[model samples]
Target chain A: MAISSFHPPQRTLMGPGPSDVSARVLAALARPTLGHLDPAFIGMMDELKRLLQYAFQTENAMTFAVSAPGSAGMECCFVNLLEPGDKVIVCQNGVFGGRMKENIERCGGIPVLVEDPWGRAVDPDKVEAAFGANPDAKFLAFVHAETSTGACSDAQTLCAIAKRYGALTIVDAVTSLGGSPLKVDEWGIDAIYSGSQKCLSAPPGLSPVSFSDAAAEVIRQRKTKVQSWFLDLSLVMGYWAGEGKRAYHHTAPVNSLYALHESLVMLQEEGLEASWQRHCDLHQQLKQGLAELGIEFIVPEGDRLPQLNAVTIPAGVDDAAVRAALLADYNLEIGAGLGALAGKVWRIGLMGHAANQRNVDYCVAALREVLSR
Target chain B: MAISSFHPPQRTLMGPGPSDVSARVLAALARPTLGHLDPAFIGMMDELKRLLQYAFQTENAMTFAVSAPGSAGMECCFVNLLEPGDKVIVCQNGVFGGRMKENIERCGGIPVLVEDPWGRAVDPDKVEAAFGANPDAKFLAFVHAETSTGACSDAQTLCAIAKRYGALTIVDAVTSLGGSPLKVDEWGIDAIYSGSQKCLSAPPGLSPVSFSDAAAEVIRQRKTKVQSWFLDLSLVMGYWAGEGKRAYHHTAPVNSLYALHESLVMLQEEGLEASWQRHCDLHQQLKQGLAELGIEFIVPEGDRLPQLNAVTIPAGVDDAAVRAALLADYNLEIGAGLGALAGKVWRIGLMGHAANQRNVDYCVAALREVLSR
Candidate 1:
């Protein structure tokens, strides 16, 4: 019954999510507990909103972190916005896009899917054609950066097309938000959701989401109540938004929000453009290193996300074995391909706090050694 | 855009969770992130499962923390265990119990109610009567510790009665697990869910849940798919349980598990019996002090939970003013009444590391001073 201290092995997290959390964010996670409704914590909550707005590039006013991870964020958007029998168009290029389809179907909405090949960006023309065919579609859902495939879709164009088709847009910015360019307002996105762990480099468990006035109006006019009461943004908004009289929903995750606040602060300090550039620069460095080692990327140069690098497994190399060896030998962690790409690709992420010159160099060198062995 | 260092006010957290996290757990929270699938982290996950099993007092192999809060944990249990048209008898005493009903109804199940007054423990006889009337009821669900009322129910007796009727039991032990005696296996409970932030004193992200083999069998025999693919325990168990291999689930929260592991270690060091005794002793001291100040209890003595003390609001005392004074002037927090008891009672929580002689003294002295003003 002796209390053993937790001793975690330090690893360079270059995976899709839970990207290496900064020490400052970790310290924030260690902040002394505050009551969810304490004025001081409320003040922190307000600052967190402003920071989230800055990170998401939206002034939607209904922006806050869902108490769960990114998948719940997706559920929140769908459950709150789309009622039963609503027709929605889901553009699927990777795992997250398919999740959106699942969410739409789960909400009892009809999903009009526009399929794209894995490891490729969602084609705006294909989406436009889908919308043209299904003119009654109420919303357009797509992944901005598909973590499963390391492809960055053209969200700006897709949202524009959806807007033209009189459809609200729901973008999955889970893996893209902090590491790439995402203009939620300028792109006319109606609703967007992102995770804290991926590009935000906080521990997973808070999902940041923003709803445009249009999306909020749709929620306001819902004929049926949101089926899942917990993810209902209407009740959640009363707690997350407002001046003084915030209604109690459930207990807010205080320390996780503190970590998120610090992570956003770090993101703001680095400046979004600079952070995006850093990811690009480090990804280029990694790409050059991998190219030198005779590795080919699954995603082509033009469509690949700087945050996630998907490489085709070489003929003689074992994808799982290489990842395992990297984890064991160098304490460097990366992601394996998911779903269709499973065992076919290795995902090397240079994301958020870990997207730096040294880590790119280190990961490439480590992969080379593991591949050779 | 400057990276400001995070400086958290050192407040005494006496409100409902996130209760005062100990310094040791806070240090554990700041540990480096590890890959969820990393061998070392998987080792931690294994240890975490064992510790949670010890805490829940269940030998169920299907035990682990859901990568979300208590609410999602509630969703997981209901979504996984109940299929479409399943009849569940929900004993509603407070908000969380209402949430269980919501979870059941959302999963396309029928909710049979056994209503209790908000501030009272659920009547086992009422539950039995409901079961007798609705013979198709598949399970009995209730909150072990009604946080809204600070009332404790007889989970053991309820579970025993359910077992006699050939029904399973789902217990919401969110606020009860560590602070009170939760004999999951001994009580014949089928499934139980708890929060990390309550008595475990970790940050509020992970939810510890355990399912008996009987409940697991029900999940295995489900005729329809669980609506929530993310929370489907069948898939989650493949990742959280078993040996040698783990299928992909969502990325687990790494550092949060580290903190949870440390908190459970702390829990074991104190021993469950000692921890329960400490809570009871602190509650008695607080009761004596509050009685000295002419305060009366909301629930009868035997039915009240030791960790959550609900006191009737004194006449001529501004509930908001006293709570604000405690928070703003003394950096102390106390919970406000919820639901029907709102403005009629004050819920003061002395949970996890917060349940100690010194905290009880400080909280009493602070309340006395604030109330005197």
Candidate 2:
């Protein structure tokens, strides 16, 4: 059988992630590939780290991008910071937090899960109670913005509660980073992992992660070797730490990093606060339009993530048929609910470059047409 | 402090891996970001698997690309197949073999080392003897082509010996797949992994891997869960299988997979035998030119990989200074030796798109000029 080059359709990505990438970012991705250790490439990597630090709003020396996706970045935090028999308090409200539990278990850490109902923020009181009961817990982990439910947790409150109990925090900022107000250093987030495809407006593949000094110190003092060698921060830091004479790690995803650098630079140019406001403004517009169509949100207004809007599927509306129609007719891609919310909700994303009046209007009109038909 | 967008210099990459991506592949990478689970994206992924199967020359149903780099692919093989308390025979001749040992230990498997000198291919006799000594060994893992030492082991002979002892074999074809002759099914390799950056002429980040029916069965029947959830084949297969309703794994590194698809398509256009011959032809040209400058190869002609030429550095040559001059003065990048051979050898790569006569001539001329200075 003969195969030819794939010409992907120009998609309006209004899904959970891989949010619409700007042409400038795409152009950056197509730039000439360079050797991972090339001096010029290394210089660019240093700048990439700086840009990531700014996006994360932290001065973490261990800030850099993981070569894989956000899942691997989540593993990096757990496998490095927690060892066998270590106790951790994990809050589960969405798919990502559940993944954190899996990572903890794989690393041989004992997890005490604080459960929250779906379409709701992680209950800070429940997390505090978990810490109170398991006073020896070494880490407190939760998702800052749950992509599966579009629920936004209060990361600062959770981190402060964890710190009061002397437990470090690992936050999943995959869908929250640039779309919302997140101050890593000021919020006392010890370790945070995010994706380039979300609010960063880059293509998928690279995961931007940061570790504070306290988190770095815990990794340095590990009694056991990191369970997953590929996700080990101790060795990864040597490659990303742009000090004198950098060490060789794996060949970084050179082109993906190029895309990330461009996206982060755009974030810097727009300023983090402005990017957050843009997402919020677009969310308001989308909300008003959806409400007019008699659609209801799964998450409450106060707890909703501006970047990702989770709405209840109206009765008698075939969930798959509507989403399929949206893609087939409008060339728009919105997400279907995952896990417990499967077939019950649709996720509409207004993230990074996708957060604009044009996309919002197109999405609303498309939904109206599809629903009416 | 303000930072501008990064503009990487156009470099002629003649390194160990990431050996010059083609413009078409780069363009494919930048085409358009798609939601990972989009129907069109899934169609592209199905085609990607077919293309990968052709490249690996396998009928293995479980063939697909890992979302991370080659190292993660390596971990995937070990973590999925070998559980705690299992014994495996690991052949250590170069850098990657040593890494396999680390992965085995991290997975709680006992590794019986079959040691060969650096720059030498794996000895089948030593492997058989290790099997003789440890009759209960579950796996035999070795590198088919050692990128660090530019040595090509006899994969067919090694796999035949491992099968005789009822042990599954895992082959690292990172630098071998397109540049050399490798038949995964015919060679009886139970599992194999390759990097996209090397012979595929794609930018770094994706690892194309294949598992034989026997290997997949072992993974399916594992008593314990795969240690790394992100790299776990059990979960990953559902997403890549593409036969029925595809399951969602981590967002499929959508753009990277697009680049891999284009590269594999190009590989099909140029027949595999032709690609191998091209690398061999370029290697001969490079070898003769290096010999004229009084440089010698570390590996014997029979064992040396045609794509990666490892040559002994002159006794008094300032290795770093020479490499820096090649980069700054000529815009060419060659790799320095790693681990045991560091500072003693230079690795000049002629793989995929970089294996043309123009690159060969330019690399030799640049080396001659830099060496004379």
Candidate 3:
């Protein structure tokens, strides 16, 4: 069977990640493939580790990308740190948060879920109360930026509460790392994971993860062996640590890591706070245009994520039809609501390289044209 | 914090895996990122699905890449198909087959192991006898190419045995696909998984997997839910089915899929028989050169893999020092044996684009130079 050469249309990506990869990242993806253990590649791996430390705002030595997507990052963090019968407090705000609860249960951890409305952010008070109720919980897990609902929770406050109760914190910053303020050290976050596609403008394979010293100590002291050998950080550390000698783990996604390093390099070039500000600026413009088009935002103004915008479907409009029309007619892509809020909202992402004035305007004009018909 | 650009050395990769990526595949990886659901991207996804079908030599519609390494691909197959209390017969000849046993227990399935020595092929007689004893087993799993020991097992005979017992087969062709004959349909193999890096000449982020209609029927008829949310094929199939109406699973690793597609295209261009012949020819030359140097192979003739040649280290030689000397002096990389064979054997790979006269000459010359010191 013969396959044609791929040439994708230059569409404006307003969907959740993969947002838009920069030209630099794309070129890096095409860069020459190297053996994963090559000294040059290992040197680059060291730079990637440092860049990840900067991205996650952590000083943790055990920082690197998992050779998988954000969901695998979730699995890596959960399966490695939590053993059977371990108690975890999961705060469910959106689809990703619900996934955290699922991971906890699947990893043989007892999940004490603190529920919130689908479109709203997780309440810090509710989390504190849950910790009070489940004082024996070993860790607190929550999403910093809920991609499905475009709501940003208070990760710092959540981590503070967990630390007060002598528990570790696992933060899912899949959509927040470069779009908002995530201070892993300042907030005392024990373990944090992010997606390269969301706000790093890289292809969606590598998941950047960081762990504080305390969390590393806990993993080192685990009573049982990590269930999933593929994701065990203790074994993977030998490959990614870049300190002394490197050992053979699984073959790393070498080109994908190159793309991630390029994306992170671009972020560093743009300046992290400036990049966050740009996402906010684009979000404001997108918010204004959507309001002009008679669409309402699902998330509250104060809690809304700057990078991901969740807009409610207008009455009598076919949600799927509008998205389909946008894709077919305008070549603009957006995300449908997930889980409990499915068919009720559309998630338009203004993330990383995609968070620009041009894309915001194009997405806004395209939506208006599609919905008007 | 400052970060430097990634510049990988142009080294000839002749290691066990992560073989040299073709320029066409690298170019495909640099393509612009698109939403996983964009129409143009979906069209490309259709092409990828068709290409994967050709590579696996099957018409299984559920075939697609797991967005992780080969190990996670193994997990996806076992976890999605086997539920708790399910009985599976795993044939362990090398590290990967032992990994299958781990996956079985992690997914809560009972494992019946058929053991063979590390440097030997899986004894089909042992597997058939195991089926005789455990006729109620739902599935049989084994590695087609044992990467650790460079042994080639009789997958066709094993699959035939499993079929006679009305059991499905899971074959780990991670190191064998595209290097040798792999007729998924003709052999009646139920489920097969392979890594892109081995012989596809792509990076290692994606795993190509295909399932028979019979295996799909079992997944459809499972009594309990698949535990891993990310690897649940039901959700993944909705996105990767190559249909116009693609559901949102996790974001696909866009550029990596492009690389996999391009590699498959390159394979088709070379023709499977020609590619297999190239590997055989190169392996013969490499064997002659090693024989001239008084080196001995681990696996017996006819059982040895053409792509992965496992050679026993000289008794007086320092394995680590010699490998380090080769890396430092010549920038050539070769595999040190894994698991039980570690420090005892050197695995020389003639895989995909790395299977050539130049690579064979370079590695042999480098070994001779390094060993003389």
Native-referenced DockQ of model 3: 0.66
Which model, 1 or 3, shows the larger TM-score?
1
TM-score of each: 0.97, 0.99, 0.95
How does model 3 score by TM-score?
Answer: 0.95
Model 2 C-alpha lDDT per residue in residues A50-158, reported as the tens digit of each score: 9999999999999999999999889888888998999999999988889999999988899999999989999999998898899999899999999999999999999
As for DockQ, the candidate ahead, 1 or 2, is 2
Candidates by lDDT, descending order: 2, 3, 1
lDDT of 3 by residue, B1-373 (tens): 4876787767678888889888878888888788876777788888888888888888888888899888878888998899898899999988999889988997888999999999899999999899999999999999999999999998999999999999999999999899988899999999888999998889888889999999999999988767677788887898888346777777788889888888888888888888988999999999999997889999999899999999999989999898778777877778888999989999899999999999999988989888887
lDDT of 3 by residue, A1-373 (tens): 4777787776667788888788878888888887777777888889999899888888899999999988889988998899899999999988888889988887889999999997788899998999899999999999999998999998888899999999999999999999998899999999888888999989888899998899899999998877676788888998988466688878899999999999889889988899989998888898899999999998889999999999889999999899889888887889888888889999999989999998988898888888878
Expressed as tens digits, the lDDT of each residue in A1-373 for candidate 1 is 3437768778999877779988888889988877778777788888888888888898999999998878888888999998889999999988888888988887889999899999999998899899889999999999999999999999999998998989999999999989999999999999999998988999887789999999999999988878776788878889998789889887788888899999998888889999999989888898899999998999888999999999888898877778878888898888888999998988888889999888988988898788777
Q: Is 2 or 3 the stronger prediction by lDDT? A: 2
Candidate 1, position A36, lDDT: 79
The model with the greater DockQ, 2 or 3, is 2
